[model samples]
Target: MTTQNLLVELFVEELPPKALQKLGNAFANVLFDQLKVRGLTAADSVVTFFASPRRLAAHVTNVLERAADKDVLVKLMPVAVAIKDGKPTDALRKKLANEGRAHLADLWPNAVDGPDSLVVQSDGKADAVYLRGIAIGGTLQVGLEFALNEAIAKLPIPKVMSYQLETDCELPGWTSVNFVRPAHGLVALHGSTVVAVKALGLTAGNSTQGHRFEAVVSPVVLQDADSYAATLRKDGAVIASFAERKAEIARQLAAAAAKVGNGARPIEDEALLDEVTALVERPNVVICQFEEQFLGVPQECLILTMKANQKYFPLLDAAGKLTNKFLVVSNISPEDTIFVTGGNERVVRPRLADAKFFFDQDRKKTLASRVEGLGKVVYHNKLGTQGERVERVRAIAKAIASQLGDAQLVQDADLAAQLAKTDLVTDMVGEFPELQGIMGGYYALNDGLGETVANAIEDHYKPRFAGDALPRNTAGVVVALADKLETLVGMFGIGNLPTGDRDPFALRRHALGVIRMLVEKDLPLDLNALLAGAVPAFGDKITDASAQLADFIYDRLAGSLREQGYSAQEVDAVLALRPQRLALVEKQLAAVRAFAALPESPALAAANKRVGNILKKAEVEGPVDAHVNPELLQEKAEQDLFAALQRFVPEANAQFDAGDYTASLQTLAVLRAPVDAFFDDVMVNAEQLDVRMNRLGLLKMLHNAMNRVADLSRLAV
Candidate 1:
């Protein structure tokens, strides 16, 4: 086996910064998958990736030396059937006769072969000859290129523009392969040598740039890929890794802040650091301070302006208050200057001043007064307006909250919901869309709304993504559930439900958010019952969508519980009980498992199985109200069994009332001994008509008692 090192580089014109990380990740995974799929297994390996605004790189160490030479007996379905008894069929005969091969039996007769062996396949299974024809040997290079190109075609990108039209390019640049952004050239190398890349509309070359502003125009020579990266850094670029860049930014921010009297503390924003890292080759950090007057503006507005507009990092005091100073990380070297510090401050000052104006203007009106403005703002085209959506949410929340025992919070949540969307009309939120909910809470509080109302405004949007924080208070939980339920019911009603991978409305997300609230919050709300409550709120607006809405919510519950390690079948079994309370379902599941594990479980199930089989066959007439005549109960064991049934019934009901299914199951277990004794001592189908009917009635009672915890027939343990 000969192992050859390979490198593929795409040195492109400014690619979209966002696409850099995704594209690099996609390439490594796809390439690794494609190569390994060819039956070549790596002994051990590690893969690391690098990307910047204009470049993407991947390095793999100790990969498979070469693809294993694949050869196996290729099986075909019914290989002999193809030959039709000992001879080929007419079509097969003609082909074989043309080749002068005669019947395959003639070459080595099946009836008269020396070793008494012939390969015959059943009609349902494969045969060797046919499978052999399609088994092309697994070769590394040809297959790798094909796999790489297929994946590259599917990579997601934005702002694609292309040139260099090729007549036969798989996707010609002008109409075919558009880069995430425009491309200048490509460089793919194996160790120190250039490999094929233009088939991908990329040139395989030894040359690449160090930095757009710093390096010379002539192509920089590289002895090896690793040296190429080292040279680029020496020439002025910090292109090692994303993690390295992020760490460097943090290091500089901390050092610079320490020089100040109170020093600086890093605010956590790995995402922000990542984006700035892409825009530069080498990183340099500068600290600047805004006027103290700017702190009067909402901290979110300050954050939005710095992170979004200027790509600057905001500083915070140890108390978590926003300080006037912010950090601006530049990609250029210090000598390049490039107006790096001054230019950033120029952009931030105007944004800061605009925010201050909105803050002052919003305080002029109370939040209650602004609730009327939501009517003018459309929430959905068919749904009337934001105010209308809030009306529906308020009704739904109040109804759900009343059941959950948070009636007081419900009222406050309703008030919060009433005014939640009004802030979208605010100048602050209008200019900074991400600030919608956050600013609403701020403005509502400033307008003299109570803490509960302000919190509900913000909490309603809690858990913006999976694993994100849920609402911290009961009022927040109430409003959040109401808001998501409204969205889900509305979307399904409109026939705009998520299908396949498309969920433009993010219905699944909303359902997940709702599920998390009910379960983790222990809201004492059953999803099914809560869903039923929400239906009246949707009113005639969404009658047909009700079943679809319920199913979607249950599916989300299945996913959420499955993540917690419950199997789909177990969840299905518990849900089959039609639990109206989530807490009850959880309790029942715990009880059932404890009961199911008992030694008595299989035996009771056996008795119930016998009862079900007999009841099914006899078609026992008219709920046989046969009273056992003790004189007719000629068998002593029969009399003994009656005594046991009398004892079991009362305690069973008591256990169920106490919600002690484990004890209920234990109570049922008591009947097993009597059932076994009666079956052993006497035949149930006695000769006397009244005696047989009485016996069957007794068995029927046992079956009814066992069905209470779960369908025991399902437990055929």
Candidate 2:
């Protein structure tokens, strides 16, 4: 029950702040799980994980003394170590020499002098067997560096390097994992003892130094982890929690900005805040003023310039108009305000001026005129030009627009998709790649394009992350789906499917984007047919990769549906037909979900639980031709179910044909009561082969009705 506080510090040559943060967190998580699995428990364990440019550290407190007591331990020895009849061999004789316990080796002391260290000696026979009474060490430290390396490699840390030595590499990006990022170094410790931790070009050690600016060479010391962190804060001045650092920055910024002009608005940029927090240790908020002339530039362009180039937050007045002031988060203390403020202001001025020039340049030429120039710009070496992609998108848009049944949405698809990539060629987008879609939409709107076209330009890149927002406009959905689908189809056709997590073209994302559009937008999209046509229209350029490409998209469908909380079985059932129609697949998936939630539970699906009896027997009897012969319907349950089918079929068929799948499913749910009663009250095997086959035929008819909606039997209610 004895408790311990543990600290591990890894000092490297300036780790990127993001990587440091990830490493810190990964170490904390890996150690927590590792201890738990080993039955290490404590009253409490609080771990503070933090990182700086040069160090990664975790401070763990109230940890159990050691891993829980082990019930068993077995050590494997080579056949050369075991003599005939399971006696200790001469090798054991020599090993006993060190311990001064060689009673059994007295007869063979001279025979063990050979230095072969053989896995199996030249005995006439050799055997591998478990030693009955092998015993070993009492406890282990569970090298912290080993655990940290594993977890860090899994984190989304970029700029991983590759050391030339094979043994030095902790991870194998060159050998083929998911990504290309390389690992640097790891520092593992148990309490305060150093441990080895090398895997993919990384080596583990005990010593870690502090930040270069303040606690430069005061080797961060800890009797255990808790005390180690206290030393860091006291000496290094590191704000370990990025969120904590960010909040501190915000509070200071608000107070500073209020001093300039009370009741002013604070520009929120959660992303920019995080990035800025990474670059600093102690933060000071600075509010600086710029000339009013810069306000004449497009606010978005100016904002992007300020945030991206200079890492400054814009200030706004009560009316939401851009103010002359900007708030800068400084890394140094208040005494260094003059130096930091001047430096940031100097950097931002040129960016705003460049944006002003670009805005003026873009005003002279419309995005509409530039749309044709996209043809000359290369989209891909194999896929021809960006202009050609626009053409494919046009074809895709036309196809989708016909389904939309709107003239405006249809015509805007061509213009929107064409202009969607035009921003990729813009000076603004070139300066800030993240603004590609935003800038295009702005330009299209300024050039007098319709709202649909402008929105389509933006939404084509919507839902960029998991569970993010998606395009709401119909034209936007078409262009967005087309853009992603074309990339997926093209890469898939090139036999470049994502395997073992390696997707150079982000095919996974492209497919997920398509899934979101089809499901959320409620677009009736046949993904396979759509993607198949997408690559071929580029002049039969992607012939062999079509099948591979379809599979890639389907794999993404499984991922996206799972992300939405759909079970694997339901996904498989809907995808059973390789459903070209995403709407159809999702409809079936939803139907299965509903069936699962029913009160009677399985309803007809309960029959599947006895598949060995019902399905096996029915398949042997073959398909039930539901052409009612009336005389076959002798039982009351049977007659009622048959009549129910008759009543439900016309409506179900009409609903199914009209694409009212949910209504059709509700119509099928009517059979559940009669189905349960029939199974309970009547026996299908009636001591006559004709009767049994006839009943089987009836059951098959009901099953067929369920299939038209979705394979309800797949639902495990």
Candidate 3:
């Protein structure tokens, strides 16, 4: 088969910078996939995607001009109905007519279907008619058109813009189309030939416009698919590849920042980089500076304003401190670039001024005064105001602090919890909700609060997302855990548990945050006791969801353990005990893993499982005292197992009490021999009632001793 590389391009008005990367990738991948599906591409076809402010394009190698013809099999009705009297019957005629094959009925058997007659017997009665013939393959023109339409229709466009264009016909009138931008041109080329395709009211061609102001030619003509990139770069004065353009920008930014000296570097943000790359065709990095006094505002505020509003990269010093200088990526290069730098500097002054104003205005009123304002702010319709939520959080925090420390710690946590959400009502936080907890800490310092209280206020929202740091102090940890638990318990109490991906309350994150603090902090605080303490803080307004919330937390913990690379069996075995101290879970899992690797592990696990099943079936009345009367042991196996238990159980229990879980579990490996012998030789359900009960009591004692760290039966498999 003859093959050639394919080229496609869509010229449009400037696209949304944030969504441009995803749109370009989707367009290229979908076009290549659709072409491959139509057999117009080979298995090894390679695709390259191009995205810029004004264009989305793709180049695919190993695409075919026309797909090779393939044999297709068509099944028809039973042979008995079609081969009547050895001539075509009415039923066959109708079937052939419906398929547009009526004229070929005389040659039906001769058309294809090997030497075997079209008739095939089935069940000695019904026979299905078969037709096998070559199918005409698709051409580049047809396949390209289908692929083009599919790719455009499936673009991950954040928002669509509608425009009108004239129809390419005599009865011309404007037709409206909705796309990410108003597409003005399209190009589809196979080798050096233009493929016949139309999109957005334009026919495919081999030429497309380049950089709006720098193109040497009005329309850059591509010679072939392989020449697209070179042609655009040379004649078009534009880097057509997104990756190349981004790299060029990064290089220029680094060079420009180095020229600024003082060990200055551009603040690295990939999302900002991608957006800036999408906003320019030929990047020219320009250094711009503002007045130093604007740095009085928080660096986060200035940095966010520059990156979010102006699409600029703020320069940072070696100490990781923000400077007044920033880098701007421009689309044009001029001999004297003073105007571009001056213009960006002038434009950013007001944005920085507004941030400074918000910061100054926010500090004038201390956080203590802002507490009353939160009462007016609604946290949730079902959960009352942020003021009420703060009270609940304060109670939970103080209770947790009291459990962990002295009076001073409790006081610090109570104060921090009370002030944490007050920032949500502050001017700066109102402008940028991301600064809620941060601004609270700042305001607390200005109010002359102790460092511990201010720090706790800010750190209360720690571990907000995956991989984020936890609270830095004990008071902070207490307040943070309380705040998260308050949200979880309140929402769950009102039957607002998360369903699928609709966790509007972020219950999952709150649960994980609680788990992280308890485990990572190793606070010795009981999770159930904490939850129980939290439930009553609601004070009868919400139903009790303590049990349900505990289960939910355990489920999240199980998933978190699996994601951390623990096997399902290992996780199940450890979690089955439902150990209250989450900090011990990892240790328990480690212990179980070590125990399972012992030579006698399999037999012990199986024996533990069997013992559990027998005890469950017996459903013995009351707690069966594991104390066995030595005289009742009628078999040697039973007597031997009893002797082993008496000797080992105390040692294992001592180790467990001493927190030597690994050593404790490993010690039980010695019991496998005696346990197996007892199970193999003794009938747990013996006819003699006393003997059966004694055996059950013995197994019960064994089950209790073996499962202190984890449920050994879970490792049976």
Candidate 4:
């Protein structure tokens, strides 16, 4: 088989900016994978993808012109029906005909003698025969067409557009096709020879349009697969590669920001950058400015409006504050820059004015004034209105604060929780839901509320995403934790538990938020107790899902701990205890890991496991006595182990009480030798009932001492 580089392009109308990259990647990868499946490319073949506002393209190297021939076994009907008198029968002929191998029907040989024979009956008779045949390879024309159709079918289109295409000479009427956008042209080249493939009612060709406005020719003809990118850059005046275009835009953004001096730089938002890159073909960054008075609004407001509405980059100063000047990525470069800059400035002024208007009007009333408005906003059909939800949150927060600190902290948390959702009705937040907590903080300050309360109101929604910062103070922490718990417990209570990927309320994220607060902040709250307290706040609207909620939180904690570099065995051992104080989980896990590394760890862990199994089996008759009768320690090994536990357990308990978990576990390591000996020589299930119960009691006492920090049995290999 001969091999060459392959290029494929699908030209269309403007694609959805947010979905362009995903669509391009899906198109390229699916096509490449299909080729590999069809034996047209090797596993090591390289594929490069290109995506812009108007096209999706892929360049694959080492693609074969024809897939190599292979021997494919095609099964025929079984023995009794396939052959008669050592010759093929009618049923086998029909099977071969259906497979397009009727001509080879007579060539099938006679059946052999035994189990390895081709002939064997269903009932153990020597009459069944199975025939097989080989299939030939496919050509590039057939394979490429199949791959193109399959790739298009698998494109991850956010929305599909239906359009009618003029029929080819062979088909006279119109044909309707659904795609991400209306298809305009397609280019598929295999080392300068156009692959015979058709898609979206168009035949494959070696030409495509580039930079609708800057192209030197209407349709720039690609000479070969290797010349596509360079030709598009030179004559078509377009950067065909998405990555190259993005990098170029970054370079221009930096250069434009630098021209302003004073340590100014473009706002760093990768999502915004990608979206802007997708909206342009030939990017030309132009510096524009708005009235400095607009900066009076919050920088977040200005930055969001500029990036979201105008698709511009707002430059920031050395202090990371938004400046008046911004950069625009223009698709065309005009000789007179004033027209372009002035036009952009004119277009953005109204957007800024709207943001400023919302800001000014939102400050007219105190957050407390918006409290009653929440009564009309339904939180959930079964969970009542936002006003009702606010009451629940306030109660949970107050209880948490009372536990964490004094009356002042409780009062502050109460006020913050009460006003947290008030901003949802504010003009600024209503216009931009992303500004909910931020707007509340600003309004609180304007109402003469102290910074502590203002910050609490703002940060109650902190750590909204993975790696996001937590609440700034104790009051904020209390309210934030309460809010997340209420959501989790309420959702789980009403049978709204998340199933698969359908968590409409982001319950998974809320669960993770709680875990992050508990483990990362090292909060002293009991996880089970928190859930228990939260369930009551929902009143009759929710069931007691406290137990289920705790399990969910622990599962999230286990996954999160593993992600942070703890091994599965280490995590299982620590979490097996279901320690109520999650803040100490990491410490316990650390101790477990340290203990597992000891020289005697393996023997001790196995013995611990053995002791646990014995206790479980012995408990079926009745509860095993925890009180070990020392007088019944008949064996020397048992006596030695009992003596070791009496001496070492207290020292370990003392270190554990002192918060030196590592020391506590290390102290227990001293009993490993005696534990091994006891399990080796002593029969825990003795002939005498009293002696057996006493031995079981000794094992129970040792198990309790060994597992205070972690379940050592879980560490056994």
Candidate 5:
């Protein structure tokens, strides 16, 4: 069988920039998969996908014109049901007729082995009659048609648009077609031959429109499958491949930034780069500038405005300070870029001016005054207004700070927490909600509240997402913890827990944020105590759901640790203890891992599991005390185990107290021999009541000492 390269393209209106990359990949991948499924692709076939503002295309190598015929064996029915007295029954005849093989019913008796044959085989339950036949292969036109339909149906369209197709006079009526964009043309070629395929009411062709303005040709005619990208680039004035176009834009941005010289470079934002790449076919990087007065505004605000509003890249200096100069990725590459640069600069000046104006107007009223406005802004209907939420957060922050810091730290934390939501009412933040906490920080400094308070106000929302940085100062840490805990406790209290993937409040993110601050900051705060402390702030507004909230946080912590590459068993053992200080969890996991590697681990773990089971059963009768009577030690094995505990338990306890978890677990490793010997030689449930209780007590002591770091019983399997 001979194979040839294949090219398929869909020409349409501009696509959604944010979803273009994903849509392009999905389209090409689905097409290739459908081809492979239909056996239209060769074993060594490879596919390359292209995405641009106006089109999505794919080129596949080693594609076959038709799929080869395949030998197929299909189970018809059970042998007992199909054959009666060594002859075909009515049921078998009807089955053959329905399958369009009615002649096979007559040929079944004499023809036992051939291209079309019936054989008996067991289908794991009963013997079944199998129909062996050579399935006819599919032609390229039909296979390609199926593949095109499947690919179009499976595209990850963010939103679909419905448009009416223009009909010929013979057709007379309008037809509605839905797609991401109004598709104009579709190209499907097998080498130089056009494949008979249609999608979204358009027939396959060899020509497609290219760049809207700069194309040298109105419709670029592709000579062969391999010439798609080259022809588009030369005659159509378009770079067809999304990745190549993006890389070209980046290279030009770098070159333009270098020309501006002063150690300047474009702000690095992959999302913005991708969006800009999806908006243009051929990119022309142009440098534009604004007045330096806008620099007085926060760089974040200005940078965000330029990138988000204008899709421009703000240049940053060596010190990572935003510069007046910014780069624009334009679709048209005119010889003289002055008009383009001037137009972009003129357009951005008003946006920057608006940000500066909002900033200046916002600073006129200090954050303290804006605190009154938050009462009108709703945070949650059930929870309360932002004003009420602020008070709760302040109370929680004070409680947390009092435990971790001095009177000054508590005061700063309270101030920061009170003013944290005040900026939600500011004009700047109202316009750009992303700058809520950020604008508060600026207002704090403007009010002469000092850098400590300003930093806390800003950093209170730290770690807004995964891997984000935590608060910078002690006050910030205290306030951040309080803010996150208040949300978790309040939401869980009101029964607005996250179900499946629908977390409208982002409760999971809030829980992880709380866990990150507690564990990473290593605040000497007890998990239960912190949750309890947050409850009083809510008063009667929420139920005391601290117990459920603690479990939620621990679950989040366990998941996070596993993602960090610890095995499930290790995470389970450490988290099983529900260690109060999450900071110690990693160390505890490390210790558990070390102990599991010991030659004595398996036997010891098994013995520990056995002891736990025995203790559980003994406790059903009465509470078993850890106090073992030395005089009650009758068996030699029991005597030896008690002596070993006396020798090692003290040292292990000391290491545990000193925070050396690894050393402590290793110290207990020496008792494995004695423990195994005791389990092997002694009868735990003796006939005598005193003897049984004493044995249970000895096991209880062993269980307590072994589980200080982590429950070894979890490692038993």
Candidate 6:
């Protein structure tokens, strides 16, 4: 069969900007997959998708006009049941009738193994009667209709809208149509031929409208499948591809930024770019500006208002300071350009003014003044108000600070923690919740709080996401840790742990934040101790779930370590010890990796596992002592092992103390040979009770020495 390119387009009202890319991709992919499943796509078939505010379309290459016929096998029934005396039984004839092969009922007795024949074959368990037949090919019209319907049904529309078709008004009764948007037209072409298909009450055609106002023609007519994009662009005044349109917009934005001079550039926001791309069919970047006096507001406040409220890209100078200028991705281009730029500037003035007003109104009240309002705002019903949460955070912050720094640091941490959530009550934050912690810092400075305290208040929410920077100062670190810990402990204590993908509390993120601070900051705090200490702050409001919370944190750490390119074996070995000082985990992992590479690792690791198992069993019988009695070193292998441990363990301990973990593990490698000999020649469970205890003690000492850096047995294959 001959193959040709195919094109399909759905013309509709503007789609949701955030969901346009997904809808377009889903439409094209599902259509291509359905066609391939029906054998209408060639081996080399490929699909290209296009999406814009008003349309979603796909182009497929190497699609066949008709699928090729193929042989099919139909299993009837057991052979004995299908035939009687070499003649077809009634059951066999009935089965063939159901298969639409009733004419073969009489010919089956004389049938041979051919395209349309019946034969007896074993279907794994038993001999069965099979019908071999040739299936007819499907025409492009039929295949395209099915594929189109399937694609429509599968589009990832965020919400569907229901409306009455114009035709429905003329009928006896009204009929309603549901879709992401009201459908205006449908286009389906196989090569130059229009495929008969219908969707959303519209029949397939060769014509589609474009650029509601700028199109050279009212309806751009595509001549063939291969020329769809070019024809649309030439006559319709629209770019047909989402990616191409987005690239063009980026180029224009850059060019516009360059024209502004002073090393100006548009702030990079991919999500904003994508949303803008989805809002316009033809993009023209225009530079616009607001009054310079608006710069008195925090640049963050101004920048956010421009981007979030206006969907404009704020221009930043070489120093990353916001300039008065911004760029707008307009849907149309005018030759004069002045009206377009002036109109955008006029439109954005009120938005900037609102931000300035909120900022000015907010700075009137010091952050300390807002602290009382937090008591009225409910944080969580079970956790009481934000005021109560703040008090808990202050307690945790003071405790963490006392361990990490001097009294001044502690005071700063307490103050920062107290003020961190106060922004939630401000006018600016009430207007834009994303500016919560950010506004607090500004207000802190406005109150004449020292830069250190202001910085701490601002950065207490640092590292809010993955790869986000940690707190910039020690006080910030203390407060951030305390804030995150309070959330985690309170949520977990309330039996509100993250289950599967339903972490409404963002407990996973909070847990990861805690892990990042502890591990990356190399804080000297013990993980378990931190959790236990935070529990008292909750008083009767929570249970002591510190044990469960510790496991959660360690689990997060293990997953993070694996994602960072460490082997599962390496992570398991290091984390198995439940090392309290998370700062030492990285070093322990590195030491484990180094030890695993040694030639003696496999043997030593196996011996260590064996020793662990023996000691575990011995513990059930009584207690296993680490003190090895020289009198009980009767076996030559045991004596040699003890001598090896005596000779090399001290050096390993010293290296471990000095934080030279790799050296420590390497120094212990000397015991591998003696360890292997002891296991091979000595029986851990001796017939003599005293002798058995001594052997257990000897193994205990060896086990302790081997696992100081990591549980070496976990490295075993």
TM-score of 3: 0.95
TM-score winner between 1 and 3, please give it. 3
lDDT of 5 by residue, 296-346 (tens): 999989998998899999999999999999999999999999999899999
Poorest 10 consecutive residues by lDDT, candidate 4: 111-120
Model 4 collision count: 5
Candidate 3 lDDT over 174-293, as tens digits, reads 999999999989999899999979988889999999888999998899998889989999999899899999999999999998999999999999999999999999899999999999
Better of 3 and 6 by lDDT: 6
lDDT of 2 at 28: 65
Ranking by TM-score: 5, 6, 4, 3, 1, 2
Candidate 5: give the clashing pairs. Answer: none
C-alpha lDDT of candidate 3 relative to the true structure:
0.89
**TM-score of every candidate relative to the true structure:** 0.80, 0.75, 0.95, 0.96, 0.99, 0.97
Which regions of candidate 5 are displaced past 4 Å? 112-114
Which candidate number maximizes TM-score? 5
Tens-digit lDDT string for candidate 2 (1-717):
576666555555555654555655775677666655555545466767766555556666665545554433122345554555646666666654554445435533233323211133333355532222222322335534335555555655565554343442577534422322334445555566655555445566554455556653566544444455556566666665656777888898788768877568668887787777777766778878777899988687777778777778888777777787899877656555777777777878887888888777766778877887887888788889988888887777777777776787778787787788888777777777888888788888889896888898988887787877888688888888888877777666666677786877777777778877777767766666676667655677676576766776687788777877999878865665576667667777776677666665465666644532585666665754545556876789888877888889788889888877777777777777888888878887787776766777677667667677555555654
In Å, residue 688's CA in model 2 sits off its true spot by 12
As a whole number from 0 to 100, the lDDT of residue 7 in candidate 3 is 95
Off by over 4 Å in 6: 80-91, 103-105, 108-114, 166-171
Better of 3 and 4 by lDDT: 3
Candidate 5 lDDT score relative to the true structure: 0.91
Task: Please give the distance, in angstroms, between residue 241's alpha carbon in candidate 4 and its true position after superposition.
Answer: 0.5
Residues 368-469 of candidate 1: C-alpha lDDT, one tens digit per residue: 787888888887786678888888999987887777665576678778878777788888888888988888899888877877788889778887899989
Per-residue alpha-carbon lDDT of model 4 for 567-674, expressed as tens digits? Answer: 999999999999998889889999999999999899889988998999899888888877888899999999998999889999999999888899999999999889
Clashing pairs in 6: none
Q: What's the TM for model 6? A: 0.97
